[model samples]
Target: MLDERAAGVFTIAATPFLPDGALDLESVDTMVDFYVERGATGLTILGIMGEAGKLSSEESVAVIARVTARSDVPVIVGVSAPGLAAIRALSLAAMEKGAAGVMVAPPGNLRTDDQIASYFQNVADVLGDVPWVLQDFPLVTGVQITPKVLRRIFDACPTCKMLKHEDWPGLEKISALREQEAAGARKISILCGNGGQFLLEEVRRGADGAMTGFAYPEMMRDITALAHSDPDRARDIFDAYLPLIRYESQPGYGLAVRKYILAKRGAIAHPTARKPGPALSEAAIAEIETLIARQEARLSAL
Candidate 1:
């Protein structure tokens, strides 16, 4: 289970697909192996980046069962749904298949602090014994959870074990949450998750680690490890990869870039995203190649 001491990079895995848009289950093993070799301490599947919403309930369980069976490290499945019943059902199904924990994001309609806190209370009540991660990604969820509200949730729900913090421009929120804990509020794991863009700063502000998926998770591992030891060295490594990080962080286009890079590296056989997501343009592909080239040279220098 995730806890206050949970640290190191937990790679958010992608759901690989064949050229015909079928699930490439073979790539599931290859990609899990790739993350472990590259530096993932744990794996989070069916996250936003993993195209979780696109999968059916049966497909979701199949993916979780396959990944947990193959992975030696703990796996956290994104089980957020539009209702408590669905969330409860999915969480039980996921844990029955050996997931260490499940993640839940607030629904889009939640507006006030009470709504957010109460939503999690319902989650905790429904989940009962299952541990969960509160995904505080306002940009996607449109439900802003203030630090004070977070403390209330902690006070109310003992089962909310972690926070997938993605409130952009909220490095101070990380500091605020840690400060709240220091002031005797319940302390829980805080893993920053904005695709590793603010990883260095987030760690410095007191995030436990990253629960983000960048094409190269080794950078997150190396950066977080060095940041804990030598701040200067971490900044040096972070800057080297900043250009590519920015490029790969595009909202709609980012996943395509990641899939292409993974396929090029032979971690997967195909780079196709599911239906309704556009393919990468020739020009965009060219730009990514340039960024990859520059990233390589900078890494070698470092």
Candidate 2:
């Protein structure tokens, strides 16, 4: 099971869909192998990148079962829902299907710190013994979780073992959380996830590792590996990829770009975002290709 000791790249695996928008289970197998071979220490399926909200509950369970079965590394399933019953139901299915743990993001309606803290306490009560990740992506969730509120939740929920720290300008949160842990607060793992834009700074600020789908899992792997021992080289590699990273970080269109690159890398067969999700324009595709070429050239030069 996932614990506070969990570290390293847990690539947020994309849900593969055929041109007709069917789940490409074959690609799920290949994508699992691709991420693991590329040095992913774990795989996080059914995440924002995985199009979790778009999938049916049955489809979600299928993904959980398939990924957990194929992954040599541990698998974390995102089970965020509008209600605790849905969260508990999905989390239970994920655990029973062999997932290492589940991830939960707060609903956007949470306003007060007490409300936020109380919601997760209820989540913990429903989850019981299932180790879970608290996904703190304020940019998407519109729910800001302060470090103090986090401390309260952690103190209350023993099974919440990891934090998917994706808050923008959140490096200070990482530092603050570590300081709190130093002062005897619960010490859960902190894995950052703003498409890895702040991964280097995050690790430097006491993040355990990255939990984002940056398309290039190897970059996260290498940077985390070399962060403490060889900061200069790490920065060099990070700089080489920063352009493509920034390009892929665009809101609304990022996942389309990510799926395109993943398909190009042979991790998946098609780049189809499901209906209602954005698709890349021809000009956007050209831009991403140019960025990838330049990024590769820079890395080679380095």
Clashing pairs in 2: none
RMSD to true structure for each model, in Å? 0.9, 0.8
Question: What is the per-residue lDDT of model 1 for residues 179-263, given as tens digits with 9 covering 90 to 100?
Answer: 9989888889988888899999999888988999898989999888888799998998999899999999999889999999999
User: Whole-model lDDT, candidate 2?
Assistant: 0.93
Clashing pairs in 1: none
lDDT of the structure predicted as candidate 1: 0.90
Candidate 1 wrong stretches, greater than 4 Å: none
Error of 2 at 186 (Å): 2.4
How big is the positional error of residue 79 in model 1, measured in Å on the Cα after superposition?
Answer: 0.7
Which tens-of-lDDT digit does each residue in 208-242 have in candidate 2? 99999999999999999888989999999999989
